[model samples]
Target: MEQLVFYSLGLGAVIGALGVVTAKNPILSVLSLLWTFFCLACVYLLIGFEFLAVAQILVYAGAIMVLFLFVIMLLNLGTSEAADFDTARAMGRRLPLVLLVGCTLAALSILAAQQVGGTSDEARADLRSVGSLTDLAQVMFGTYLLAFEAASILLLAGTVAVVMLAKRERRKNAA
Candidate 1:
């Protein structure tokens, strides 16, 4: 049952990712990415990482996707009349980079699996604590509190700057 669910979620994620890359419309691509994120969250849940599952849904599927949709709408990128998009040409151009990245990821996955398999039971038990919300909170608030706060402030400042620049641009265009 668990294996079936895992494979189903994995398939959904792969299909969603393919849709994201192949969809002609920006909105449709973003929606496909959202679906991929949801599938990933389900897989995380299946693997006993409840915190990661929730964070994946809330952060990537919710906040990041909303931001993507907002940018697509703000830029009015729904139409492809002005720009000709040759899917085959684009894929050809990126094929080498994609293959390189896929190979690198495969190597890293094999290495990680080997390391995990060689670890003692005690080490593996300790690693499982990493997925616990209590451990996550402790690490975030206790050890990396300052860094976390700094990142949040930086994100806020960036948001404000973008909004200000956009507003100024709109006003100038209106005038």
Candidate 2:
């Protein structure tokens, strides 16, 4: 039953990722990415990482997706003009390389899953403690507080930069 759920989530994630890549509409792509994030969160839950699952939903699906949608709307990229057949041709040419890389990644993921499944029950118990919210909060707030703050500041700076650039471009176009 657990394996079935895991595989289903994995398949959903993969399909969502493909939709994200193939969707020409920016909004559709963002929606697809959100679906992928949700699938990943479910997978995290299945693996007994409750905190990670919540964080994935809150951080990626909630905050990050809102930011992405804001950017897309700000840029007013509703629909892009067709790029003739050049883009299709280019994708076709790279199809084989993409397939090769995807196959390799899939094999590695299966191997890693097998190794994890082979871990002793004791090791799994220890992982549960590590994945606990209390331990995570302590590590994040007590040990990596500075790094966390730095990352927050970086995200703020990036948001400011994007807004400034967009305003400047709008002004230029208005003149």
Candidate 3:
């Protein structure tokens, strides 16, 4: 059951990512990104990482996506023209390169699947260790402090950049 959930989450994320890439409308792309984040949170839940799952949903879907949508709306991004067929044709020239990369990724995924078989009882037990919010916090602060701090700094910088970019220009009226 857990394996099935994991696979569903993975497929959902992939499809959502494709939707984000292919959707011409900026709003639709942002919505697809929200779906992608939700699926990832679900995957975390399936793995018994409840705190992580909640944090993912709260930080990503709740805060980040809202901020993204607000910025898109504020900037009047809806009026941008869609990509033309000529652009698609140009992009088609890279098909061979994309296929090569896809093949390499598929090979790596196959090898990873072979190496990491179905989860055993011990693996399940380990997942239960940090299932609680308190345990998850302990692990985050103790084991993953550096990664956590880096992410916080990255978020802070992104927020500042967005605010600066969204500022409007002042214009003087001719008498």
Model 1 lDDT, residue 163, Cα: 90
lDDT of model 3, residue 92 = 97
| lDDT of each residue in 63-157, candidate 1, tens digit only | 98999888878988755742556467877898999999989998998999899999998898788778978899998999999999999999999
**Each prediction's Cα lDDT score?**
0.88, 0.89, 0.83
Candidate closer to the true structure by lDDT (higher is better), 1 or 3: 1
Error of 2 at 14 (Å): 1.7
Question: Of 1 and 3, which scores higher on TM-score?
Answer: 1
List candidate 3 stretches off by more than 4 Å.
84-86, 118-124, 127-132, 139-175
Instruction: Judge candidate 1 at residue 129 and give its lDDT.
Output: 76
Model 2: per-residue lDDT, tens digit, 70-167?
A: 99899887454534423878889989999999999989999997887899989888977788788999998999999988999999999999999878
- TM-score, each model? 0.74, 0.73, 0.64
In angstroms, the error of model 2 at 94 is: 1.4
Clash statistics: count for each candidate? 0, 0, 0
Q: Which ten residues in a row have the lowest lDDT in candidate 1?
A: 78-87
Candidate 1 deviant stretches above 4 angstroms: 81-84, 137-175
